[model samples]
Target chain A: MIPLDETDKNILNAIQFDFPLDVKPFEKLGEQLEIKEEELLRRIQRLNAAGAIRRIGPIINTKKLGGVSTLAAVSVPEANIDKVAEYINQYPEVSHNYLRPDKYNIWFTVSADDENRLNEILEDIEKETDCPLINLPTVRLFKIGVMFNIR
Target chain B: MKDIYIQLLRITQDGIPFTSRPFKDAAAELNISEEEVVDLIRKMQSEGIIRRFGASIGHRVLGITANAMCTWNVPDERVEEVGKIMAGFSEVTHCYERPRYPDWPYNLFTMVHSYTEEDCIRTAEDISKATGIEDYKLLFSEKEFKKTGIRI
Candidate 1:
């Protein structure tokens, strides 16, 4: 694990909670963290390089923005996991692909600009992988996305 | 105005540059004022188009190692109620009511993240106890091949 100082944690907390909207937003964040703006930016860059901070930006509600997404899962044999995953990853729309321990082992989510595009992608994935995949669409949104704070 | 916002979304969808003025860069790209860009962000946020403008930290880096996609066979009648209860837990990041297939006997899905697998299982059991939905399956992720937010 990358060692995170208190300032790093605070920066993560600040960015996640509410990134200030200002001409010099990092300056404002630095003031909040009692650090210099340069230091703040440097530390954030370091965190980014370390893969600690995934991205510092908006979580667009694509579904609300005329886009479609669905959860799809396939059961790949142990040896062919990487090959199948790589094949699925070739599609730019496929995101959050994880290998889970189940009959349906490789669980992935895909989002596209529209429903037709989404279906097309899923069909291609199923056809290419040669696996019986299930497309689990969201019936209801209990919690759309979680804003997880670093505790 | 709507067209311009679409361009803005395309520009900002990947992520704002970590530079001093993120909105300023997008504003420059869109040939609009920085104030206008920020205003559009606020407007989109208030309108619920922009879910939340924030950073997503690597959970594993912060000692949050375990991750479980816990699916429950919650009754159709109790999906909403049980979903709310499941979402109430701090560890449950995502909660949704999804349709179940003939083979797949789970409807309610919750993504649980914790420090360990044991913690995740315990939390799932706790959820089962609280919701009184005894049937559940915890699909712990063995490997994360790809995990990035939506890109337009």
Candidate 2:
């Protein structure tokens, strides 16, 4: 974990709740934190480099943006799993994938413009890979939200 | 060098409150107009910067049971087909393909949820049968270390 200073923790906490929407958002944040914008930038960079944060960007809800999204898993032979994962990750539609302890291990999220297209991509993958596939569409969204407690 | 992106990322992940005039209330605290807040959120959404602005409920509070992450070892040639079949399940919330590590045996992954663990297991069994893959395993989350939005 990154060793964060008081200012860094404050910055992280403030941003998690209310991200300003302005031409100079960071400047706004700096004002609230009573720090220089440059300092804020430097701190974030340092934290990111230390793996305290994965990414600093927009978290779009593809479904709200008129796209179909679903979580998918594939089971590839141990020897060829890496090769297969590389192929699947090549598509822009895929967001995150992980290896878990299960018979069917490669897990990833797919988002496309439409359900039909999403299905098409899945089929294409199936035909190309010649592997049995399982498609788990979201039946219901029970809880889909994130909370970052900086306090 | 202040990176404004970090600030933006963190704020969005925390989520906006669900209120009659959430933007107005939030803006008041920030000393900004409600319109300004609305415009900013709109732009963020249009740019694919913020995924969504809504309430994120706790699944445990909702009495949801039987959540398990399942994986499979699919043939190189038929990975896509098997993935699509697995994704077709309504009970599935998440599914994906990731690089397989040497120590890790399973490759494909999917998540299933039902009223009970037994139900989830049953669903997994059905999926295995439906997809025609014999070798598969289910791993349930033992503990949640930190399940929250990542705002860096």
Candidate 3:
């Protein structure tokens, strides 16, 4: 486990929303927390190693990136669920996949460069997996984004 | 540790309290001290089990330009390297490798964000160039019926 002091917490909280777009963003963050850049980087690295920080990077707006996103579901035989999932997991288009206790047992989110490619991939998966595909793309995007609170 | 971590996930997925004293209110509901809740959250963050405790923004309201899910046919030998490289992009969110079906030819998947569809396409093209993977697919979101953090 990683040890976090009040300063570390403060630094994390400050960066979550206000990650500066500067030459040395961490340096600015360190200045805010009254800590050395080297020390702050060290702490962040330690926290990441401990899994506290999954990543330290900019959060971009994907929707603005000119692509389509969708939540797709597939009904796979229980016996072949793992195999199918393994196959689905091999694609980079799939963002998240889960095994739900529903008729649509396997659900995942797919984002692609365009609508055509997305449909093509889905159709391919359906044909190969021998499982029916239910393409439930987002009709309305309700909400998206991650919030990391320090306190 | 497992149980507590699950509880933490449940709490976050259920949604953080939307109040000035959100932690205090959450503690009250869970029958724990506010201080305890805060401590637990801190611990969870430090442990990396809980990546971050924050808000889920409304992209539509913010007028996001575009977003798409791009899948690549990464060789099994270089899956990890490609995944790491894809994750390095600030515009790419939710990068993971899913299994490919006979019908589903591509394997590496990444979600890219931009201000417009053209931008997303350009980014995907750039990624294609960078990764040197010619065969891949792009799936755009048609509708988001329900999107929420799982409470389990």
Candidate 4:
């Protein structure tokens, strides 16, 4: 892990929330931090190259975009984890998938334009993996955003 | 959805290009003014279509190695109240009230991130203390199969 300094922390805190939607966002960001635009961009590039800044962009609301998502978990045997994970990752709709240390080891979040498509993708995944999957759609989304205040 | 907004989403979904004049570059591609791009984004924000517009930081790179998906077996009656409290914590990234199954009884799910497993446990304990819901299980991710932002 790269040790982050005060400036990097400040930059992460700033960009993790709202990035300026202006033409020269970096310039505005730098102005806020009392840094030069060129310096700010350079730091951001370094951060990106170092894998700190994954992407600087808009976080689209899937539901607002007429999409539906569900959290699905499947209990994969120890031997078939790799093969099953590969099969599950083949679907573009499976955005976040993880092998959790639980009975239902493989957990994933799948999103699609609608319920039908989402189910179709999940169905295909179940068929391919030959595993019974539990679909736990959000009953109520209390919070969906994550902004780690890296101070 | 307007054609222009669709085009804007398509262009911005991958991420806004890191450049001096990102909006201008996008505007030039879509044949729209920079102000138009900004205006559309602002509108989308107001409409709750854009949850956030910013840099998606890689937490693991920042030494936040531990991620625990904590599920609470809260009572159905108090699920909402507890969920609201859990959602207020900075460490609680994602919180939701999901339906319970016949075999699985966890109803409230939360994703907690920290630099260590102890930190994650502390966060979960804090949530438990705050909500007074102690029946919970934290499932740590052994391996990340895939992690990507959906381009919806």
TM-score of chain A of 2: 0.71
Question: Candidate 2, residues B98-144: lDDT per residue as tens digits?
Answer: 54556454567677866578878898999889988888877875433
**Consecutive 10-residue window with the lowest summed lDDT within model 3 chain B:** B143-152
lDDT winner, 3 or 4: 4
TM-score of chain A of 3: 0.78
Model 1 DockQ class: medium
Every candidate's TM-score, chain A alone: 0.79, 0.71, 0.78, 0.86
| Candidate whose lDDT is highest | 4
- Lowest-scoring 10 consecutive residues by lDDT in candidate 4 chain B? B13-22
* lDDT, residue A46, candidate 4: 89
**What DockQ does every candidate get?**
0.63, 0.07, 0.05, 0.77
Q: Please tell me what DockQ candidate 3 reaches.
A: 0.05
What does candidate 2's lDDT look like per residue over A1-151, in tens digits?
Answer: 3455788667665665565555456667789999888787677566555544444335555454466876666776778766767777777777666655456566666778788988887888777776556666664332232433332
Q: Per model, how many backbone clashes are there?
A: 0, 71, 71, 0
Q: Judged by DockQ cut-offs, is candidate 4 incorrect, acceptable, medium or high?
A: medium
lDDT measured at residue A118 in model 1 versus the true structure, 0 to 100: 91
Looking at candidate 2 chain A, the ten consecutive residues that score lowest on lDDT are A142-151
TM-score for each of the candidates: 0.87, 0.48, 0.51, 0.94
Ranking by lDDT: 4, 1, 3, 2
Model 4, B31-60: lDDT tens digits are 888988999999988888888888888888
Evaluated against the true structure, the overall lDDT of model 2 is 0.61
Q: Pairing residues by index, what is the TM-score of model 2? A: 0.48
